[model samples]
Target: MCWEAGLSTEAGNSVDPRSNGLFGVYVHWPFCAAKCPYCDFNSHVHRGPFDEAGFVAAYAAELVHFAQKVPGRTVQSIFFGGGTPSLMDPRSVGAILEAIGRHWTIDARVEITLEANPTSVEADRFRGYRAAGVNRVSLGVQSLREGPLAELGRRHTVDEAVAAVRLAQSIFPRTSFDLIYARPRQTLDDWQDELTEALWMAQGHLSLYQLTIEMGTRYYDLFRAGKLQMPGEDLSADFYELTQELTQNAGLPAYEISNHARPGQESRHNLIYWRYGEYVGVGPGAHGRLLINNQRHATAAEKLPFDWQRKVLARGHGMVTDDVLTWEEEGDEMLVMGLRLREGIDPRRFQRISGRAISERQIAELKAIGFLETLPNGFLRVTDKGWPVLDAVVADLAA
Candidate 1:
């Protein structure tokens, strides 16, 4: 079904961008120089030539297509995420930004961000990207150690990663980099030393993720073959607890489970997702949540890069999935995303979305078990004790 948000005096048609809460845009660039063994993101190694101009035009058309569906809102954030957005030409990025500005009333303080992988060549382009209006940059500096970098199939060395981070910090007003701990052979002492160094390099924000073995990745194949060994339950928990302690003491607290940031430095684009706000996802394999006729519709695009570009050029969009979420699905999703945040979820908003009240019996059980708590302002949050088993808590509550 087509989701059309016409300009009418409807409840969702709020002109003030902040009036309707946060609105954002996500652009996915689907090419990468090389594929990592542990990566499961929709990325590909495209050989031969890439038509940057054609892809840029397709992106612009896709933006206009979504603009028609959802209008009269200010864009608070725009994120270029992907295989490796740093591989993109700066002019192409600027063109996409121009198209967004053309379609939406961009907020004066819009947080425009691009995700990059740390390489010497990509580092050289940092200034060019900043000039293209990308004010924030997140580097895929997965590790600071030489061994981890090679084991993870990263092309950049430790020195290169550091140089890239330093360059990105000097160029972008807001900069953050990622680190993956709990690797196949990573020890507690190893992670501690690496994360401490990371904390020193980090300016304001850091995306610290625990290594998970997802199906279909090379890591998973090796793990099944008994070649890749991961941390056990007790060791994994130790690593996590140590991470929380170190980052907390360093003054960058965990605002979200996998992300730590200084106060006021949280990624606004990511918050649009965790806070359940509306955004448009453009390009290959990008997923989005949008308000269509006051209902939340989940959308996704074609996965292959060339195929997505072809579809966008032919039909003005590449969306292959658009499902209007049911109340139960919305509630489950709210719990899944919102409970990851330290500030937690508002029960009132949950009620409004799901049209049902949270079970008081369930809440009491969780609270008694020291897994959950209610804030003085009536927000229900997962306590630190509950966080290690967050999925189970969310499942119990959703049930």
Candidate 2:
């Protein structure tokens, strides 16, 4: 299949069928200084020295491999996420970006973001990264309070986070930071104060995530043992509502349930995910979503560093799973992701990808339950009332 722009096609067919014009690239760095107890993101602590040069060479080769697989697709965004991407040497980042530029045609306005922990060591390298083609930085300043920082196992102090943000603002054109709300023993008033402080410090974008105890996390174990004491459901709901109200009043409305941005400042790379666009994931434990010849496919990379390195060096790739999504599965995914956004999902696009529309019966049921509102633009968006009970709404749709 040949896309517009005279790009040629390969022999194999796409795994799943979907057509969304945009595409992105995501590079996951699986090494962190230390793994947070609540993190289960395939990240491991780098206790000893590792081969940075070898890793860079492997990543370059991986990019070449992907370029061959999906030729002629213009890259709109590139995100370096993970075990603290800021830990990467600026030169390595530069080399990877150079390799990407050589392999694929990138959009001139492409948003290349790197996630960093708000430590002085990382902050000092902000300028070096900017010079290396990283235009955006998402600082992992999970909280600005000392107690919460300690609880979350963050290395940086509140002062360090503030300083890092200040440095990031000076260095990068686009800067965003994340905060984890609804912590154990956190009150609504406490969160309100924290959010206010964060908004004052924020340059543009903010990702306020509620702490959830996922299976395999330390928090989950603690909860199972009845040792965890996070905010109760009622308190969590209060925090969530306060977040929506506060961010809206600040003119940084919630574009997604957990993400807030001033108009036109939303994270473009994230938008690729929420909008169901194609993205390539590289490095250990990373996942990629791709569309080729109108077929959609998902890629999961090897979970361990040594394993991923070996696979990349041997087969020129580190992919563990490259499964194609089914139409119903794709529809369900779209519903799950799109509904997270304030604008919701486009009915036409949903039908195009899912092979069926969201049933009117389901829609009526959701509206009757005060969970959704049909917009004039033909999108069914989740109402504020619906957000607090998002899981129930999703279950209703699935049923």
Candidate 3:
């Protein structure tokens, strides 16, 4: 199972101190009440007959293992993402948080976020999660319309979704919800009205994702069979424009393509990803990007629940893949992730990591083509015209 750039046990726990920065920890709980038809994330539906205790122990073991490698680093944030992290016992969540505190230095104002579904079953645990150290909750209320909800294969109703938001607002210091638009049979007008209504209820932040048919998902199967009829290109473009206008007018401009936030209210955990900072991902199917000893690496846990659990129990870690990145590969990733942020990437930072500068020739070419703009901060950012054609621009630059 080894690949190029793979690290072995003999490499030891030594890591390059130059890799240090604002590090965060991500814990994945890969179980849900039901699997949504469109979801390709490593999530599974579980009935009764599960071993929650064993899973928690395995998770703690994985955390301890990484903490050893990243000792003395301050954790700025911790995110509990999922299949549905709300399915986890609050006690387990508390224990994991305690373990993190014990293993690593944590900032006094560390942001801790937990992802929850809007279903009452999950919502009922919000207060407990808050008590257990979760300060922010991102609810998966993917749509407010009953028809759209059903179409998206969600388990919660509109009323339940609203109630969940209300409940979360009451419990957590910060709350946000997700909404997916650009579905089949949806028009720009419909999306405009829906997004408007959502903004009215949104306290400060929103995650507006366009419905994408990913490979291996049921949605993709239906789409390839010509059974899924989504909005046409023109309609989707209108929806995107409407989203920007509405959110901007609402004073919650987009910090990322799918995320909007008020001044100083962006999700810090997500910022770590967009800024290409280091993080440790623990859980089945979780992926992590780390910089150690001046080498950037990607880490992936075992995808299966039993296998991950067994690996952690045996080796005190669940990572099945830990591979370093080549210089070209790292530069390509920098371009892709950096362009996702509105702030863009600093050219100096890029040069520091990649050991080479963005070619002046390429910069002049991109600027002439109107795909990039030089910010006052000396960062190269994608222009509005470049956003819709981002894939093409990234491809060209990477090439």
Could you give me the TM-score of model 1 versus the true structure?
0.95
In model 2, the runs with Cα more than 4 Å from the true position are 1-17, 120-124
Tens-digit per-residue lDDT, 57-95, candidate 2: 988988888888887777778999998889899888888
Q: Which number leads on TM-score?
A: 1
Q: Estimate the Cα RMSD of every predicted model relative to the unseen true structure.
A: 4.8, 4.5, 6.3
* Cα misplacement distance, residue 70 of candidate 1 (Å): 0.4
Q: For candidate 1, write residues 1-399 as lDDT tens digits.
A: 101112123223363222237789999998898989998999999999778999899999999899999887678889999998888998888899889878877776778899998873465477777777888999999999999899999999999899888888888889999999999889999999999999999999999999999898999999999999999999999999999999999999999999999999999999988887888999999999887775788999999999999999899999999999997888888899999999999998888888898999999999999999999999999999999999999999999
Q: For candidate 3, lDDT tens digit of each residue in 250-347?
A: 99999888899998889999988888878899999999987766788799999888789999999999898999998777778888888888998887
TM-score winner, 1 or 2: 1
Highest lDDT: which candidate?
1
Off by over 4 Å in 3: 1-20, 120-124
Error of 3 at 89 (Å): 1.2
